[model samples]
Target: MTLQTNDSAPHPNQFALLKQRRFAPFFWTQFSGAANDNLFKFSFTVMVTYQLSVSWLPPALAGLVIGALFILPFLLFSATSGQLTDKFPKTRMIRAVKNLEIAIMLVAAYGFFTTNLTVQIPVLLACVFLMGLHSTLFGPVKFAYLPQVLSDAELTGGNGMVEMGTFVAILLGNIVGGLLVTIPEVGHTAVAIGCVALALIGRWLAQAIPELAATDPQLKINWNPFTETWRNLQLAHGNLVVFRSLLGISWMWFFGAVFLSQFPSFAKEVLHGDEQVATLLLVLFSIGIGTGSLLCEVLSRRHVEIGLVPLGAIGMSVFAVDLYFASRGLPVVPVMGLGAFVAQSAHWRVMADLALLSLFAGLYSVPMYALIQLRSQPTHRARIIAANNILNALFMIGSSVIAGALLSSGFSIPQIFLFTGLANAVVAFYIFLLVPEYLLRFVAWLLSHCVYRFKVTGEQHIPISGPAILACNHVSFVDAVLLMAASPRPIVFLMDHRIFQVPVLGWLFRLAKAIPIAPRAEDPAAYDAAFAAAAKVLQDGDLLGIFPEGGITKDGTLQEFKGGIMKILERAPVPVIPMALTNLWGSYFSRIEQGGAMVRPFRRGMLNRVGLNVGTVVSAAEVQPALLRNRVEELLA
Candidate 1:
């Protein structure tokens, strides 16, 4: 289940290296942390529901409180955590956080040992909230660290491994906690011992994570939650692509929260099952999510693949609807235990339904998080991610409220599932339609990966999907086409005004809607029109591909990037995704002299070994025209 050891491959030294300082410790630390969190939460929840003698409220309210305690830190502390992640070394901070968990767990153990409801209740809630706080601080550091330690090619796989580990740990912890609470004589002391042991394991693991400097070590800590939270949200909103990705991710959380929260009620009301069956339902969901999270690495071809989102959505809807019908003929009687529930054929349908839902949930969420990491400005990446967590919390809270209303209105659990599935379909359609970038990225990915034969590096620096200004080293006229083919989104190229009048290429450019710009002194009107078009494309979240050298290189060497890019960015305000066309320098039609033939027919062997290198998005705020031009030059070099 642990993907950490498998990262390198199956070699003699791999196992030895896995236990070495570079990998084992951090891996175990994160694993132990996840395990301990679920263990405490699951045990506390089970105790409240089945063991407590309190008569004031139902068990469902306790479940809600558990959910609330876990989510509260995201609302209040995530912004501060974001700043802290940027300001401190990740491994050091992680070690410190693990120590804090040890302290928290000891207090938790004290409560468990006492078996005092009033004392245990407050202590338990405090532990849950503290764990939430720990997660809040850990979130940004975890994301930011990957890009530093992982190569661009390894990022997707690394992320997949992390997600897989986290969820599996969750499942084990939940199962253990449930079993511990349900056991006849294990008592609170056993629970305390388990938590303390897990905490110690986590501390040992934290010692293994390699040290990496903070993304912005000088970043000031902003302690005020309210103003800083608003600021973080605004920073995320500044990039439309990132903002939309955040929304998609938040929607996924909302979907999950609603479904998970409704499980107990659904098991009891629809499946006519008892508490044990409800526990099994939760276990099935956790396992499914863990499976799906690992599968993302294979499904995405080790990249932030947006194509999986629609696929996940479709699967969710299909399985959800099937679940409704599957429960239709089931007996309206409580199942005695895990054995009887499984021995019956109907329960398998419920298990399948939960698994497929979790699988789809993983597919929908992973890419969005990766996209945000890939596209967000480095200086503010942590803050933007914090903003994402905030939105996720809000959406989940909203989902809970909506589900309660639906249940109160006499809708059966099956009916609510049907409704949620349908609503998800609508929302998915609307978001994709509004911002076609996700769809277009999939298109670009298919074209580059399936249609072309090429190798590339520095591609991570390139903005994969967004309103980007791609300034590549121009060579042949088809330079635009090759770049477009490499790109995963439709690009609006700013090309020579004369090319707009060519026969076949002209019509093709027109059809693809390439933008044509004239030199400002030559045709001011044309120049103005080109700028306007470029701005509109970027604002619409489309890529703007441009040749900043104004024309093909005549000497098989670099030419100065024209200032036209500056004009375009002034209007667009989108990030610039720099690209380099390296081997195309010697291609035919790459005019070698001034005023040479602008139109050259195809030459033999001109397209051999054509390659493109993409770099990351450069924010408009940091890019002056000269600096951007230089940055593009360096990418080519």
Candidate 2:
């Protein structure tokens, strides 16, 4: 995981803090919340749709009510919750929420054990609404809590870990919920006991969490949830980038809702299987999501990079479509356990498809969540997160409507999956194109880490206008990521030919559209082409980044500045801004490292206090490689 400090620089061991009291308790609480919510809601959904079909109300109507019960809280209570989070101690508030969960579980238990559906039904609905309130209140506090407890370096890694935990909790919860309902005598009791136990444990954990004071303590409690929710929405709406990220995240929920809510029907019609098959699909998807979320840390080296979104979308489309083909002409199978299902010949395709779908879903989601956390302001972070949750709920409701319509319109379950996968691809393309910033950031990130360590300051010195050449000391490969993270504008980097040939790193660079240069003696044509591209990029009023040191530092010191940078500058006459990257000498990506290089970033709070120092912007006429090198060296020293 990418370990960072409060200063937005890397630190080691940020991951370990996840296990500490401050975070772990809240983690378990949230985990339990997701699990319990799914367990009761899914069990209730199953009961209404199948077991309770003979009831007075139509099954579809009953099912709709159940779904509405769960979602109503987000629409009604989230605003109140967000206000509470900002006004009180989050840990204490969380403790109360958990306790409230325990009470709700009692109501649920009484309903489950009783024969009175009339009395039980309304109680269950009330529980749902209260749970929503709990979630709403918890929303702002949950997200806002992180930046308070975690240093900046820990944000991405920490967010990734939280997301990983949540997905895992969800998978386990869904599987356990499904499984518990099957046992006649123990089923209801087991669920009730589980909810109570998990809630109590959650409460205990909340208590263990350290205190986090309100961001705006004197802020008046705005009891008018609707108006305040809109106001909070307006605050989030102010940051268009963050708003887009939120929408992207909301889209993921819509996709997930469609996939998850259809499992029973999918298992029955698509796989021609029983309830167990539906459970299996849930398990696979949940496991896949958990795996994918966790993998983001490994894939991103701890930064919240958006390229993973496209990668995830691609995986989703490929596997989902493949799954449809895999299921073609397959025979239906009866209900079976894991082993039986495995033995049942037709289940293989469904399982494979489910697994891949979940995996891709994970890849698509984790970064979006982390990006919100990373990009949102520390104070209003939770409310923004709450807004995300609210949007997610709304999108999910819409997904159900769309999926139901499709299913009713003669679309097979697998066909729906196929369409959704294709739609995912289209949506991904549209979102990326609409917001090129995500793509640009990915490019910057790729250049920073693949090339060398980057340091920036007086980044403001680089005119936020016109064209500029960012000249910096090349200490390691990842200089681009840091610079990109720091730079407000997209930069077209001029890099060496050899650096563009390494395996996975090479693909990332190519994807970023980096201009690779070879010496006149190495590849003269490629060299000429690279410079031409550099000039064009500058002419387009984009920032052009280059390292004057040529390549990685070989002697633990800066090399004599090369003149190719001077050539690029003379062609553009753009302002030249110098920067120094410090404390990244020992990072795994550092060229100074030998074999057995550990490329993964350390957990937050584990790494050294690394920083990027941005120097003054010099005029093109004043640009001197030696002078720039000396200035950068002085900063490093």
Candidate 3:
């Protein structure tokens, strides 16, 4: 079901989703929760550093204890929460969590007002655990709720907005939280009051969330955490793509944990700055992620394009390494405020590297989220998201351990950043090796947008799920790549047998599982095999692409449609979408030369303006070749 998108020709943007009621309430609900989390964490951590400096109660050990207290609940409760969300309506679950947050914050206010460090610390720690529990319970609901709230085409935009909202909130929390608790004039009371107030506001906004039905209403509740967790993991492992995406997402968390865990110390030891400087660094990273997240929608044309994952991974590592270099060998200087810190050129370079690293992190994560939402089975989507959260928690916990180990072994923060950046590259390569789809999509998407000014419209006309036939006007050799880049789903392109035998393109085509076809008179076996494969593709509920014009147009005009589409429809009746490619005839792939032979190839028309327009799907019975030709011609015109 395509949830109505409020975006239209006048809006023409990803942010349009924000104006709609279906997404805005939930967006703020999650945003406030994240802000509260970071504010509380940062405030307490900063306060402890200044107030609790004894050898037995070192700031480092205090941080470790706090981290454990907060993350433990995710490890303990994520699996259970997934089941709960699946069984109960998500809005109800969401409202309940928000109400719980208010109570947790009130207790926190009481502890702060006691004016006793011993009593306040433990109470605050318990508040951290309860907050973690709140986030853990809502994790699945936050992600799994999107597919129901927005259309497939809007998934990337929705995820992007949420990511932007979350990190910006974190940035706000970091700046506000640190100063609130650490400022001598204000003290902890200000923080306590703010947190409770924020929680109340979150609860009030959650009430605006539209009602949503449970995905698995009759799902049996499993009481055992160990057994339930194992089952949930298996459920996530059910799909290879889903599992790999989960690992990628978890690795990102691990990477983020390392940086976040080191933020305060890194600011002090490496940059020689105070709380304000630490807040500045958070600002840089937060703004970077928000920028990258917003760009993902425009870059992928609002599709769950995993190509950005590799692009993000590359930028993350490169910038991380650069950050180490930027931080190294600075002259001894007294700790300074944000203004003095930015005055130094070396420090500015350090900030640039940090900003670039996190910007790519945004690009890296938004798609992984949208992909999980798009790929996971709707009935078990929340459980799958729960599994992701559990893994994410484990990875983060492990990151703290590894970073601590490295730091204990005498590695400086710069060394750790360099090594961590290199580690990101290795892990990303390993994941890409396992699933090349991410990389291939990256290359194709890059080719379409960067190499050419390719534009697309009517992508929403394609069916969001199940089997469908994409019948298009074949214009050039590069048509397949551009189409694949534009499409929402992986398409099995029916290729001419001879082109399938071409050296470089053939190998790539084989990897994409493009079908090889020949005229029945020339090669009956190849012709028969192609049709059989096309039928099986549709039957198994996958997209199949057919050049109903049979071959590339020699005169840049729509060619006569072939009978293959009709035959395929007869075999496996499904929706047939008409697509047309324009502005490619003069390029090397087209037959623009004399005698219908090609001339200069490969970027000869460098940065050419190309257009790929998709049209609404037609019923199988209405997919007559003559009518299909008319539809293609009209779109091209």
RMSD to native, candidate 1: 9.2
Best model number under TM-score = 3
Where is model 3 poorest over a 10-residue stretch in terms of lDDT? Answer: 1-10
| Ten-residue region with minimum lDDT total, candidate 2 | 1-10
- Prediction 2 global C-alpha lDDT: 0.73
Q: Where is model 2 more than 4 Å wrong at Cα?
A: 1-15, 46-54, 58-61, 332-340, 344-349, 443-470, 473-625, 631-637
Choose the strongest candidate by lDDT. 3
lDDT of 3: 0.86
Q: Looking at model 1, which ten-residue stretch has the lowest summed lDDT?
A: 1-10
lDDT-sorted candidate list, best first: 3, 1, 2
Q: Give all TM-scores, in the order shown.
A: 0.73, 0.74, 0.92
- Whichever of 1 and 3 has more TM-score, that candidate is 3
**Model 1: residues >4 Å from true position, as ranges?**
1-24, 55-58, 334-336, 343-347, 444-637
Error of 2 at 536 (Å): 21
The lDDT values for all models are 0.74, 0.73, 0.86
Q: How well is each residue in 174-238 modelled by candidate 1, as lDDT tens digits?
A: 88887777777766667789999998888887876888777788888889999999999989989
Error of 1 at 183 (Å): 3.1
lDDT of 2 by residue, 1-637 (tens): 1111123334545457566776777777788787777777766666666565446657777767877777888887777787777777787788888888888888888877776778766776677777766666677677778778765445556666677677777777767777787677677778777777877777776777887777767768778878977987887888787888888888888888878888877767766666776777877887788778767766664545665777777788888788778877776555545566678656677688788777878878877776676667666776787788778888988898899899899898888888888888888778887766676565555445444444444444544446878888876666665677666445678888787777766665665677898888988898888888998888887788898888877645888999887778767777777888887766666654353334555622253455778777677889898888888888788
